[model samples]
Target: MLRDRDNVFCFTANNLDNSLSRLTFNSCTASSIPSSTLQTPPPITYTQPGLYNVYFVSDEGLPTMQVDCKQIRVLPQPIIEINNDTLICQRDTILLVANGPNLYSALWSPVHNTIPPFDTTSIRVHPQEDYRYNVHLEFTQGGGCAYDTSVLIRVSKVFADAGPDRFVADGAYTILGGPRMSMGQEYSYVWTPPTYLSSIVKPNPTSRPLDVMAYYVTVTNDSTGCFHSDSVWVRTECTEIHLPNAFNPVSDVAVNRNFGLLNNNVVKLEYFKIFNRWGQVVFETTDTGKKWDGTQNNIELPPDNYVWIIDGYCVNGKRIKKQGTVLLTR
Candidate 1:
């Protein structure tokens, strides 16, 4: 017999039953029943992986059993999980794993659209830029889906290389500029001669001219590839030395032929000397332009070659010493 106490039912059957009976209850309503028939509702199942409250009730007249209510949970979908949120210069690989069972597909997305080579579960990824990455896992069971993590990656920027420096001439002189100066960085420089120059040496060229003039300059570099140059031009004037072949020294009544002095009369005769082939002083005189008369101590001398040494002053306040060979025709 089964009796209804209020909303609960009571049943006293003589045989044990194995069939499961489905129970219905108002989620917000509460009812009292004997604890004998409903000691506790068999563990309840949930539709999703979250907490849910379950109500238990017995036959309305069953006063011998008491019922209790509790909560249950059903696990959600699968999710892809990553171990780290960042990578460094040395260690750049990212490890990934699935957080749920029955995962059929996995996908990853970068906010910046920087595609990574590895996009599946248990992926090893190395990102080259700063961005956000997300992992999406799709389960094989009934369209279940999950996301484990989103991470930000920072990639170091490689710096650009710069070239070398310039040159100047005569270590003491200033440089007008053959080649312009360059920044001190990491780069190679190849310089040809300037349009004005016709030299072979490149960036560190030697003997290059700044203009079409007779200027010469050399360009070079330091041990570490730094550039420098030196330039120079012929700065001295041309000079010449004029000499006479012979001088007359016969004191004549009509023609007192005399070599005179250096350029006419600016210098006075100091001393005159003559040397033989053996470098001996053979003849000397203080009378300006006095000829040897081809004589040695009143004896007629032979016509042999002799050397002459002349000492005089220049117009520029400089003294000059000249030595040469002269022949006595007499």
Candidate 2:
């Protein structure tokens, strides 16, 4: 059965016994059926449609009669084509490729509910939460049956712990830890130098120097909703500076200036010589806070016990020389 209008081709063959209607029924011969035996043959037009095989010959100088076979099958119109969809994180495997040409299986609809029964076309969905995926394909042509189309897969959220943030300053105290999640997911921190000092015990931390701190940390992905955060700012200072045993080198804002706590970026004084224990030379200066009133050479020395030779520059630029002994109290 075939029907078309315009280029005209209409066929309906039931039982036409003409025996061998003197050959020449062309279907354009490249062998796709219809070859020889003409009575009234001239009607063929097919743009595209299935199964077709028709060849008949009963005599044409002998060897032109090879039975008579006829089979023209063309009834195809069941389309369902889909390819390319991806979401593979932590792997639940969603790879479905459908091509149309006479299919016979595939049905998957997941919004969360699948363990072992969805009738495959390639579906492995074990999404315990957050989901969207649909599929339906069942095609059979010859008995006429068709259904195919499905697209929806967006499962985004994959974070157990996403890196970088660490702080440690152990002088007045400050400690923090990070980038943690591998099956040891148990974290809770609500800290901002609160609790009067600071305490974070899920990764261990403690800090309080004078408490000039602003810190934030929130990490919670216990089962899977994904969470990660970090923040840091700790500036606490009281770092060593205590020197004032006795400074009365004749007060001028009370002796010398640079008795202590004068870090001109880690103070640098090279050779601040001063002697006087009968070794002469007193009240020298390397500009490291030059001060020595019980002088000599400028004359004023008599209460002796001063043999100082201090040279300096410390902290990562190291250079220090010492030969101390000082007490010229007059």
Candidate 3:
């Protein structure tokens, strides 16, 4: 029912003399002044929706009477109200849901595109700058008797950078979100793998990995939820390779028997070399995954001591070098 404004109607009685007529009119509503005793019952104002039968009766009261009746129809107009929404780390698409009809307009050119078309009560729009749609919903259901209602929708715009791909030292923590996470404020955020992040919802989070595997992050929006997302990679860089104090070079165990750096990945390896006590270079290699088997020219060297030196870089060209001794056991 449209109680927004009054539906008014006016009329004029021609060739009717007030001196010869005792005119009476009925407004056909219980709430309205039911009847008026004037020849031209000052314009009628109806506030409700429905069919109304207005009457104009002129009685001379002396065997003479005249009556006229007219019927008017009132139908409710469509109503639409849209609220302003916020986004950053911003949304690429948004859905506008409301009620109305006759939305033929060009006002949606700036907000986004219509996907899957649109119905009388809803529309889907895509990634765009910004927009304020002022449209009218006119209903002809009342046979050209329905009114038009105006609606305004303010679609906010926001942009985001998930930060840059970074390399952090193993067993150490680094903060995410390079420079800025968003261009605007007044919103919350979340990072994947809450297990590694110090605070998932914080703009910046500390990430620390303890093992040798890479962790992947994924984000999703719920059915009725709207949001935006981006991606970045964080890798572990091991500058200092691990070593054992001693190794059984001829032992049945492979990893436990190899006299070489324990790992080779992520970190940039420059050179790795091992020398005997007498300053004789027994093994040297710039290639990764190469290990010495306590052999000198294919002859297995007996129990002895060896010195090793390695040069490498990690975390953006930070130089690192180390030298140590390993006991080659029998």
TM of each candidate vs. truth: 0.27, 0.29, 0.38
Which of candidates 1 and 3 reaches a greater lDDT? 3
**lDDT agreement with native, every candidate:** 0.42, 0.49, 0.57
Instruction: Name the top TM-score candidate.
Output: 3
Report the Cα lDDT for residue 146, model 2.
Answer: 49
In the range 1-330, model 3's lDDT, one tens digit per residue, is: 113234443334437444344223344563255655554444455566677766655554535567676666655544545534534123455566544464333223233355644334456665354444333344456543333332333434333446777776654566766554453345456676666667777666677654433333323333224355666677777765566769896678865687775543425668888898888788887765577888878998878888999876654566678899999997
CA deviation > 4 Å runs, candidate 3: 1-6, 9-27, 30-45, 48-71, 75-122, 126-142, 147-162, 167-173, 178-203, 207-229, 235-330
What C-alpha lDDT, on a 0 to 100 scale, does residue 149 get in candidate 2? 62
lDDT of 2 by residue, 169-284 (tens): 21335455444433354444444445424465344455544334566656554555445555666653332322233334455664342233222223566766666677766666
TM-score of candidate 1 against the unseen true structure: 0.27
Report the number of clashing residue pairs per model: 23, 7, 0
Candidate with maximal lDDT: 3
Worst 10-residue lDDT window, candidate 3: 215-224
Q: Which residues of candidate 2, in runs, are more than 4 Å off?
A: 1-47, 54-67, 81-114, 120-124, 127-137, 144-157, 162-330
Q: Model 3 Cα RMSD, Å?
A: 12.2
Q: What is the lDDT of residue 211 in candidate 3?
A: 40
